[model samples]
Structures are given as structure tokens and as C-alpha cells.
Target: MVFIRATQSSSDIACIAVAPLSIQPFGVEPTDFDAFWTQQKQTLAQIPINPRLTLLNTLPSGAKVFLLELDNIDNRKVYAYLSVPAGTGPFPAVISLPAFGDAPVQPEPLIMTDFAERCNSINLYISAHNAPPNLPDPNAYKPDDLSKKDGFYARTMIMAGIRAIDYLSTRPDFNGSLGVSGMSQGGGWTIQLAGLDKRISAAMPINPAFCEQDGWRFERASGFPNYVLVGRNLNVDSNKTLTNMRYYDAVHFMKRYRGALMFQVGYEDDVTPAATQLAAYNKYRGNSTLLTMRERGHTYPFDEYFLGRYAFFEQHLIGFKNPFNFKAKFLADAGNDRTVKDTAVLEPQFLVNNEKNKVSNIQWAKIEGTGNVGFQTENGKTVARFSQKGKYLLRVSADFDYKLADPSVASYYTLTDFVTLDVGESSNIDVCDSDKEAPNFSNCPQNIALTTMGTSALANWTPPTVADNCGTPSVSSNFLPSQSFPIGATKVIYRATDSKQNTAECSFSVIVTKGDSSTPPSKNDLAISLTSVVTTPRPHSFTTFKVKINNKSARTFTDIKIQIPFPSGIVTGGAATSTLGEWKEWCSNNDQCFTWLIPQLLKNDEAIL
Candidate 1:
């Protein structure tokens, strides 16, 4: 298996440049490449997008972040971190994709940033796979059919990105100024999406992948997924790979991309070869800027490129304001996943990233782990102790403080990441202990009815009673008493998180319906809103749904009943737990439905079913 290798220097690579060409692909594009993608787009248009959004957290800059799920190809769904900026109106948007693994591997790129608030844009962050956010995923990066071009994962991945753009364009809050960005595989997608969708006004791809995929044919190192030699069988002869890898290569898609593009090239990048990235850059015939960072490698472009990824859109007049006045860098290290012996005491060393100069605080959170586990600081070093033997995922996050370029914008931002480890057997010392319970809001507020003649009304309600097992849990709400609620139904979500990062949430709605102040309302004036429900998407999986009922009148009602008919072909499952009423399941001539009956509906009070 060993053979003599011929060493080549930078000059050797420089001399092997291809013939003079612009808007050229790494290899010949399939004759039906354009037609095939057009047909895919047509198919995507027919599928309905069932969107479900659940509020996760809120940034100090008044941005509401949520986990958004949308149905995609083959009954699959795409999950993303959706950030809605403060103060409503149409706003420009940016969709940031991910590289290699399902989610962001490192702490910095694990979640999202404050670009939505600082730049006043709607931001959507997606992983390489359609997995949930903030959790360790082992099912990611599964094998795909590489024998055929159309059967490859690249087709669906690119189409999913296009569908993301389609979702943004249809949003009433989107101002139509759209941009796509990513590093590595995500970078490759950034270019491909821009090429496929005309809605993309700009793109920022950092050390992009899938570039010059056929460079191996010329005895050169290609980008990621480089199929140079199949294992040890060097004698196996094969020159064709599903249309010469033309249909799925980003270099081929570059010829069709005509937009404002600013891509970065890291001279030290080995994952995605620098030569292939340069070759793709040369082939793009449209307006593009290549920012070379000699010190960086395969990483997020925010640090390596000029200013940051968001700054490029601002510089190019893409409708976003630059929020950078100085450079803010954080290098979080949770160490790598490694197997530990019997004791399982000397866990992965979690180091603070750039703490001396810019960081204001350092924190650790346990994302997920089996058995019992806790993290403690020993001799100024972060360590984890497990009570049982198993593999676990951990995270170390640092608060980086920096001055924003815009004085009016937020002064700082936040980003998170992860680390993993495997333990043989625990020593059973069990020194470090953490609170495992979340604060409860047993007396959660009831939905209220507010009558307003104007566009908005000052709605008032009592704060929910919170009880915590471990000290006092920090509680926050998206809506406060006497806060202005727009004319319509609005959900008031309150969250309580403990010191151990355990959290609980309870939400109710405020229904504001316009009515004549002089006229008395009718017998029934109610507004009902349903909270988002998340399911496994697997067939026959158990699911749960929460529905809130608000009485939008001053008059009390008695003997009220609500009926919900189940969709056709959905086999009924036992479900019923009422907070203020009784639920009855009845079938009328083969059709199934649920009926809830309330003896008394109090004025301005809400019922849950």
C-alpha cells in the first residue's frame, strides 16, 4: 500500500493552472443540468410548507429567537434558528448555512449571532442536516448514494436552501434584500443557492467546499468529498462519477450565479484545498471579491474576512448597516471527544477561549448526558465528573465584549458551541452536583380579552406565580403587563431558567378585538390560538398539542362547548387533559372529533384544553 510520493510546492500548483476561461466549471456541466434543477424547483413549488415556530430565547437587543421547522422534500423537514429583529416592518434578511456535520461543531458557530439586531435584518441559521437546534446529534452525516448525480445529497441540500429563500421571500416582514453565507460546506451552498435563486442579492462563502471536485483528475487535491482513490484497491479503474461530478459541484453552479459575491480564501485551509477555491474564484464571471487570509483556515469568515460577513452586505449597499467598530474574537475550546479509563475523572479539558483581553464572563452548560454528570472548577480548570459510564456532550461558552461600530446598536453579541467525551466506568465519587429541576409556573396566567378601538391597546395582566426548587430562578417574559398588544391574537410567553440551565415555559394569549365602545357585544366573543406542536415526523409517533381559549368580552357565558374534527385518514389516539373543563371524544358516522365542554366561562378569563 505504500508508494513513492512526489512533493510539490506552491509554485508547482501555480504552474498547473487551466486554460484561459471565465464563467467556467471545474468539469463539463451535464447537458440537462439546468433543465434538471428547473424541474426540481417546479416540484418544490407544489409542496406545501407547514411552518411551526417555537420561541427559544431573546437577545438583549430585543430580538426574539425561535426554532423554526418547515416541511421539505420527501416528507422531511428543515430546522433553523429564526431571529426576528426588534420593531416590526419589512427588513432585509440573511440565511447562514452550516458545514460538514449536521450542526455547528465548534462553540462559536454552534448557534447564531446578533447580526439580526445589530444590522436590523431577519436572520435564519441552518445546519448541514435538517436536525433540531442546540442538541448533540449522532445521526447526522449519514451515507448518500454517490453513484448517480441526481441521487446525491447535494441536490436535496441545495433545494432545501432554495426553499429557505422561498420562505423568506414570502414573509411579510422581508424587505426583499436577501443574502446567503456559509463556511466550508455551507460556503459551497451559499454559492449554489445564489446561483439557483435570483432572489439572492449577495453571498459570502468562506473557504467554500465542493470546489474543483474533479481536480483529482489532474493529480491535484480537490475540495471536500474528494474521491481520489477508493481505499487500497488502486488497480480499480473508474473515471466517471455521475456525470463527472458536474451536476453537484459548486464550481459548475458558479457559471449561473450573477450576484454580488464576496468569498474568502484561507491560504492555510487543508480541508477545502486553497488551490480549488482559487480555481473556482477565477471561473466566476460575475462581480466578486476574493479576500485572502493567510492566518485563517476552515473557519467562519467573520474573523478572517474584511471586518465581518455581515459587513460585506453593508459595504455593497445590500440594505444592512455595519455594526462593527472593532474586532471581537472568541476562541472557545471544550476539547475533543476522547475515551477515558476506569475513573472517568480526568475528563476532557475545557479551556477558556481568549479570556484575558476581551471576555467579560465564562460559563459552562451541559447540553445532554446519560446517567448523572456535573461540571466543576478544579484548580482553575473546568472538569466533568460522571457517575456512570457512557458518552456525553458538553459546552463551554464565553461572553465576548466589544464595542460596536454603530453607537446606537447593541454593544455586544453572543455565540455558543459544544464538546463531547466518552467514559469507561465511573469511580462513584459523585462530588459535583447540579440542580436537575426547572422552575414551575403552576399558576400560569389565564388568557385575557382586551377591547381596543385603536391599532394597539395597553393590555394588563398579573404576572404568573413561579416556584423553584433550587433558589430563585431567573424569569423573563416577552410581554409585560400594560404592554401594547396589537389588534389581534398575541401569545405572551414566559420562561424560567435555573442556574443549572434547566428551563420551563408557559404561555397564554391576549386577544384584542376592535368593537364599537357604545354597542354591547354579542353572546360569544372569543379568540382561540394554538401553540406550536413539535413531533418526531416518524409515522405513528406520539404527539401533544396545547390549545388556549380567550373570552373576548365582559359578559360571562355558561354551557359553552367547542368541537374539533380530526383530519381524514388520521387514526385517533387517546388524548384528553383539561385544565378548566371536560373533554369528550365522539364519532359521528365514522368521522372523529373532540368536544370540550365548559360549564362557566368567566369574563376576560382563558381556558386551556
Candidate 2:
């Protein structure tokens, strides 16, 4: 619950923490924590793993790559990219977890080619969610609701990690030196897996999220998936939510973890704040080392620090000598210029002093802005100009090629510089006047210019900031009419968000007169009834359904579409008939479903399918 901020003499060096590590546990350890997990594992053990492996031959690497899939709890499947070094004997194994977003997991051969070849081990990069890796939308597998105790998202994700280990144990080349590594949510999973599975030998979690759930209560930033605390404007039962969260808290797991742990923490990380990480680190009872970076935030430095992690695994898992001697310094050309105009040019420089290391690649040199600011090389040095006015952080990372004994590993390091661009002040906007008896919805004004003084002035408004049943109002520089609103006074909220993520919001009321307009109809005014009556009682028998759609509203409905989902076992022979509508049947993942579309339904009209 205590924080100490340590100032650094150089911007390259992060501000370190002066506070002593304290074991300030947040949530109470559930009384049935052990029993609950035991039951979970036993339940998972009962399911048959209809495992499947497909070799990927296009990506040529030192190791053989295969796409592996196995069934987990909840009928969800685990998809991972497995890489095994070409060898018959057993090898050390490592499981890499993913971060906390919808970011795609690159193909195994493309991402882990270097690490697998260097470690000469089996690497399994599993999807954080139930869906396949590199999915266009990773949130597709996200649970519908997290408040439910029995089927929480984190529980399934944690079990996937455990089940991944179970799958690894069954492999013929399993050497048993299992280690888990990941950043953010992945880091939290590493802790959860290492604690739950005794077979795990080591774990390295970087800026792990989902720890210290009570930090926000003490006025500190909470970790990712900040579930315990309700939203800024939300109503929920906090006591019940907190009770369910304690079951999966990483700090509680850290207390029971018995594996070798190398935890990396960023002193300036707002996502997984240092205070929260320390809370878990201080309580760890196993052999552990805390690697602290002063200048880093939510991201890993990826330089010598990351190399140290690889070395940790190499030493413990494969008996390789630790290549711990590596150093690099990041320099900025702006010097002490903390604030600059958006037109100013900034160039970053890298200083590598270690003789044993070589900069193999310059990954990127870019600024963190709302939009892309094009980069160009000037004077043989990488330079970027700020396009939009806002605060920006210029980040640079490079891969350092080095060797430790027989294995050659590439260590990536990153350096960042913070700067603010003055784009000028945001302009306040006034709501345009509308007639009280205007037919249909009034057109919210458009092209309301923002301050042009800065680099770029862009405007956006929060959706549903003001609730009007006339569909959500749309706003850009100008307001546009959405759906027709009922005759009433409704407030519309608008805001301008700058490149720096700064915002200015304003609200105005629009009064609609009750001249010729009736009250807006609710979306739930339509009623649907589907009754399935079996024509034959035996298996593979024909089934008939009585479907009815009734418009229980005074307003006419247009473009009415209804989708009916059926179980996988149901074999759709085809739609029998439809009255005043068109019906179509489709199959998704071999599951039959039906959709009906009605062009228009008059008030109080009914249609049967």
C-alpha cells in the first residue's frame, strides 16, 4: 500500500522505486482455493483430448513446426504452434503466453524461429483465448460475461495454460524443464500456471497484469481487466465481484508457487503498476529474482533485460552459461527540449558500448501518437516529425546478436523518449438550434471546426453519451441525424480528442415538439414465437416448427430480420413455408441455423414462418 518514487539523473534511466518490498496482500485467499483447483483439474482430466497436429512445411527453420490443437474444458479447444528442434532425444520445453489484447500471435515459425533454434528446445506458443491464433478478432473468444462465478473467462484461460502443460507432459520429447513467460496478462498467467502446476520448473512474467486488484481502492492504478472496480458510471455488486476475483488472483498464487521465478517489473508501468507487482513479488515463497527497469512502462525493454531472461532459462533448463554482460544506451537529439512545436524534427541515436554485442537489426523508431506520423531518414539518421499536436513517446528497439556457449541468442532492447507537442488549445462548440416541431430528426450540425493552431485538429464524440431512443447520435466535426427521436428533450454530448489523447467535451439539449410525431417505438416491440413439434419420435426423424412474428407496436417495422440458432445435431432439411417473408437456412461450423427477413410489417401485423 506504500509507494516510493526515485528520480533518475538521465532520461534514459527510469525512475527507480525507493520503497521497500512489502507483502501487502489485497484479496483474501479463498478457503477452497486448493480444493476448487483440484476439482477443476479433475474435471479437465475426465475429458478426452482428441488431439490433432498439422505440420507447416512452408516456413523452413532449424526446428520442425506443427500446429497443435486439443480439446479443453467447456468444449473449447486449445490451439498452439509447436516447434521442436530436429532431434530424437527429449528436450527442454517452454510455453509462451500472450499479452492482454486482440493482437494476433504470429505464426510459430515466424516468431519463435530464433528462440527455438537457439535454445534447441520444444516451444509451444498457445493462443491466449479459445479461438485460433492470429485471429482477426481475438475478442471473439472472450466470455460473454465475467461476473458469473462458474464460467469466468480468466478461469478458462488459466485452465488452457494448465492444459497446455498437460499436453506437453504427454509429448515424447518432453524433457520436463517446463517454463512459462509472457507480458501483461500473459505474465499473470505465467504466475497462475507456475503456482498451480508443480511440474513447472521456471517462470518469467513481465509487468504481469491482473495482480493487486485492490490497488485502485487505495488510489493507485489497477492492473489490466480491472474487473473488481466498477466503471466510472456503472452499478454492480462489488462484494460479489470481488469474491469471485480472489479465486484467480496472481498474488495468492505467487504465495504458493514453488518454481524458480524471474519476474520483470517496470517502475513506470501504469497498466501493471510497480506497487501491484511488488505486492505479488514480496509474497512469493519460491526461489525468485525481481528484475527492475527504471525508464520502462507497460512494455518490456527487450534489450539486455530480455536477454537476461533467455539466459535464465538457458542456465536452468539447458545448462547453458549465462550471457549476462550486455549494455546499451539510448540518446535523443532534442536534449532538454521537453516541449516542442508539432513541426519540429526529432532524431534518436543508440549507443552500444558492449564489445561482445552487435546490433543485428533496428526494429523501429517511431512515436506513440493517435495517428501515424511518417518517418524519413535525414543525414543517414532516422528522423520523425510530429504530425499531430499531442504528447508523444519516441520508442526505438534493436536486436543484439550474441552467443552464450553453443547457442546463439538475439537480445532485443528498447529505449524511449517522452516529448510533448503544442498543437494549441481545443475550441469549444455550441449546439446548433433546431425547430421544436421539425419533421423527422433534426440534423445535428456538421463541420464544426476545431482549433487549427496545432499540427492537426480532429474531433470525435462519445457514443450514447446521451441516451435517446432515436438510435445513437453520430458526431464528427459536425453532428449527423441518426434515427428518428421521440418528441422530447434529449441531451447530446460531443467531444474533441487530440492526437495526445486529450479531450474536451460539451453537451446541449435538443427539444423535439409533440406536433405530428408519436412516441418512439422500442426495439423489443416485436414478439417472436417458435414452437418445434416433432413429426416422428425416432432418431433422424423429420421435425416441424410453428414460427410466428407479431409486431406488437403502433409503428411500422422495416427491414425486420430474425435469426434462429439451432443445435449442431439438428439436420435442416429446408424451410417448409413462410407467410409474407423469405426464409433461408445456413450452416456455421456444421451447426444449422435459420434466418427470416421481412421487408415491412404494418402496425399490429403478424407473419408466420
Candidate 3:
């Protein structure tokens, strides 16, 4: 198909004006994110380009709202409009990337209002030139050569985002501290800029797409025309291109991005597969967090209401208290099959009390008007009371927060630092509020017991029963009394207990031999084994000696202990070896089998005589 172009020429460039807003600093400093970006080098530029400036609207508060356009100066000029709080000697700056769809898009007036009035932060809506006079018809932009590498329109739009950052930095009143964020395509671009750009201190990407390509959709999902166009444009060399593109891929780049990030995804999403998103999430090796929506999908408010998604940006971008910071993730319920349940145990050290920085305490505690909830104690220990069960969100407040011991800290932010726990089958949830100053574990009660083994008829010892809040308890095992016996065995009994204090004892009997049964392998038949008898007495001059053995069905030979009586004491010798195949040698002077070989003989499939 031959492509047609329409051009609109006017010497005038539409400008976005900055709102006179108060910029608040999050008080956080920039972090080093070298290894993170190293993995995403192929898909990203070492330095971002494209800068433009324009005026938008005038606020009723007598503040001028301006837009700064960052063009992807390499080829296509992607534009991002930045709105700053006018008049100042450098105020904190916030750069916003637009959501997926068209470019040069403006946000809801309320969002702009929040950025200007409430957040006192600069705002930007960097969009692709997909609209009117400046852009080709959306339908005209097809996946072809020119549009792939040199003209992937969305990539150019992202270039505009970079330029917005440059433009914001040049402002006399713009502080170096910066924040970048967006949803969907904007989210993808935000993550890229946060990882590739050194100037941003924090980033928030909500309901991000393009996390995993091959992971789920195999290629691209239906209707999404952006990335396919990019791949085609880059003329991605079949073999080497994918290898190289892996570096530019968002999932790959996430590994190197150092800016603190708050990523949100939905579990029931049909659009972006959870597995693919999780693959990208796993690559983010920074001061970051992951929030999951159980019954949500790819929608607007749903993405916004996704737990910590908005709060992450509120704290990182606009400098506000994070509503989701409770410390210690006690309840991780991915209602559908998509839940991540790898929660480990929460350590006790996080319960300490500090009285200094209320900020640190807030980091540890959940302030509920009157008081806080957690293990709060001035001494060394903290004990909180739990009245009911269910999923409980715990928050800990501490005065002081301590730095990690060393670089060995794989996760700087502990799951235990903010937690959610499910209590009671009907009431089993008991959440704990912890602090970053202590040890943290995400999900506790991680079932690590061996569930299955190869042996079909093997005896599975019952898992030791566990009870809580009963102090340190002990466990002991007991075997049933046995007497001298013959073949025809019935049962063998064993018991386990934790003694008197709320002790639970379990007694079970295993049958060694079964003549015939319709049930085949019953519980008793499974735990024990009985094989044909082999009589190999210690060597004697005559070879065989008669020993009286009683066979009583009522007496039950299962627990019967037979004494190997020696008529002339035991003497290690010959013929006995021939009678016994691999059977172990008997003890000299004592007509008894070798104690060490009991395990071996028990497993040999031969019956003990």
C-alpha cells in the first residue's frame, strides 16, 4: 500500500504554560543505577535528547502554566509538555509521561489541578504528535519501514519526554530533584527515562504495557500497533536484533534502572499477561515495590486504585506520605491463580521502639488517628493483642530508622517492613507492623515440607502437629512393647506427643504382612513390609538346630519380639552364608542379626524370620 502524507504548515508553535505551583522535595537523593541500565542499553540511548518550550494556559490563581516539549531529537521530534509553578529560583520538578493512545494529549483538568494546587509540583503530559495538523491520520501510520526505526511514532513521542526533562532542567526556578511517571505507554516511557536518565530521583509506572513480548502474546497482542511498528522500523536484524533489542526492552532495562519505582499490575488482566509483567517486574533491582490488584483489569480508576500505585508517585513524585506503607506484607492474596505467595517469615527485631524521627516511626507504623498498631514496646520486646482473624494490614511506627549493615542486602526494603496477613480460617489473620530498622520477611508460613516421594508403599510419618502461644514445647516418640513371636504378624504401634501442656498425641499401627485384602494396600499395609522368611542361623557343626517359636493369631505377632536363642552359642562360619543371599552375617556367640544391617535387611524385600 502506498502511504500518503498530509502536512500543516504554520510558523506558530503551540505552547504549554507552567502553573505557578509550589514544589515540594521528597527529601530523597539520587541513587546509582549502573548495572540496571547496562542490561537495557540496546533499546535505550545513552543520553536522551529533543527539547522545546511553549506556553499553555493561565491559572485563575494568576499563575502561568507552560509546557516544555522534549523531542526525540534523533529523527522524529517526539514532544512532552512540562507545566511548572512559575516564578522561582529553581523549584522541585515533576515530569509526566502520557498514557498509551495518542500524543500531545492533555490530562483531566482535575489531575492538572492537583499537580498545580495540591501537589505544588510541576506537571508534564508528553504525547506523540498523533493529533491534527501536526500529525498524519492515525490510520495512515502503518507498520512499515520508515515508521519502524526512523519513524516509530511512539518512540519519537518518548523523545519528547526526554526533551521535557531537558527543558525543565534549564528553567531558572527548576530544582535538580525530579520525578517521572505515566500509565500504559507513558508508563513504559517513564520506566525507560527513569532507568536511562540520571537526573530523575523517582519514577512511578502504573499498569505498564510492553513488559513481556515473547512471554505471553508470543509477538504482539491484537490491536496494539506501536511496538510492531517499532520492530519493523528498527529493521531489527533477525537474529542479532532481538539479542540487541533485549537491551532496550523494558523488561531488560528494568534490571539497570536505579530510580526508586512503584510498579502496579492487575492479576485478572487479559490485556497484559501477569506472567509477562512479572518477568519485567523481576528485573527491577532497585529501591522499588510491586502492587497487585486481585479483581482488576486494564482500566483507568482500577489502575489508579491499585493499592500502592498512586501512593508511590504521591510520595516519590509529589512528596507526600505513602498510604500503603505498613511494613511487612502479611496478606498477599492474588485472588485468582495469579497471586505471588512467596512470603517468608517476619523476624522479631523489627519491633523495637525508637522515639526520634516521627518520620521513621511513620515509616514503621500505621497511624490511625488516636494511636498506632503493632508490636510497640520501649524495652526490647513488643507484644500486640489480636482479637479476631481475617486479612489484617499492619503498620509499625518507629522514631529511628537504621541503615543496612552492608552491600549483602539483596532487598533494601523488606516485605516485613510493610505487611498484610490472613488470620483465622474464619479468623486466622494476624498482621504485624514493623520498621525498616529491623528484620523483615514478606510471607511467612511458607510450606517447605516434602509433599511427595517416590516410594508408593512408603510410611509417611505424620507431620508433627503444631500449636501456637503455648511456650516452647518438645516432641517424643514411643514404640509399642513386643514379646517373642513367630510369623502371622498383625500390627505394630508407635506414638508421638508434646507432653502435658495442651499436648496432642497421635498413635498409629502398621501391619507388616497381609495375607489377602480387597482394599489392596490399606494404611497398615502401606507403612510396613513383610517378605518370605529366610533362616540362616550362626554356623553350627550340624548346620540346623530346632528353636521353639509360638504362632498365635490372637497374640498378634506384629509387635512380637522373637529372641534368637542360641543352642551352642553363635560361631561365624560357612553354609549359613550360602543360605543367606546378600543377607548380612550374624553376630558370633549371639544368635542375632546384625544391628547395623537392620535398615538394609528391612529394605531388601526379604522377610525377617
Better of 2 and 3 by TM-score: 2
For model 3, the stretches where C-alpha displacement exceeds 4 angstroms are 1-52, 103-110, 130-158, 216-241, 300-314, 317-609
User: Regarding TM-score, does 1 or 2 come out ahead?
Assistant: 2
Candidate 2 lDDT tens digits, 328-348: 222222223366544445544
Measured with C-alpha atoms, the lDDT of residue 272 in candidate 1 is: 86
TM-score of each: 0.48, 0.51, 0.44
- Encode model 1's per-residue lDDT on 1-609: one tens digit a residue: 011222321122112222211213346677898898898888888887778888877777888887878877756667788888888757888888877775443323323456666788888887556577566567564434455555566777787887777788788988898888888888888878877898888888888988877776766667886644431133323454635466777876776776777767765566887677776765554444445544445664344344666456775435576677633333334455688743333322222223342443344544466755554442224556677777776554444434334333222332233456677878765433445767788778888776654566666667887756544689998989867777799999999987778889989998877756565445467877665355444686655666778887785444567887767866664766776669877645544777788665557788888
Which portions of model 1 miss their true places by more than 4 Å?
A: 1-26, 103-111, 136-138, 227-244, 294-296, 300-302, 326-609
Cα-based lDDT at residue 356, candidate 2: 26
Global lDDT of each candidate: 0.65, 0.61, 0.41
Best by lDDT: 1
Question: Over the stretch 1-609, how does candidate 3's per-residue lDDT look in tens digits?
Answer: 011122221132221111101111111112323453343333435445445456667676544565543334444454444455535534556666655544323433535434554345666655546332123446434333332233344444544555566667766766676777677666767776776677888877766665654331244332122343455566754443233333334664465576676666554445554444555655554445445443445543432333333344454553432334422211111112111122212322332212212222223322121222334342222444343433444433222222222333221122122245543332223323222122222122221111111111223233334332322345455432222222233233222222233444444443334323232323332233222133553444334332222222221112212233333555533332211113334555455443111211122123322
Question: How far out, in Å, is residue 39 in model 1?
Answer: 1.6
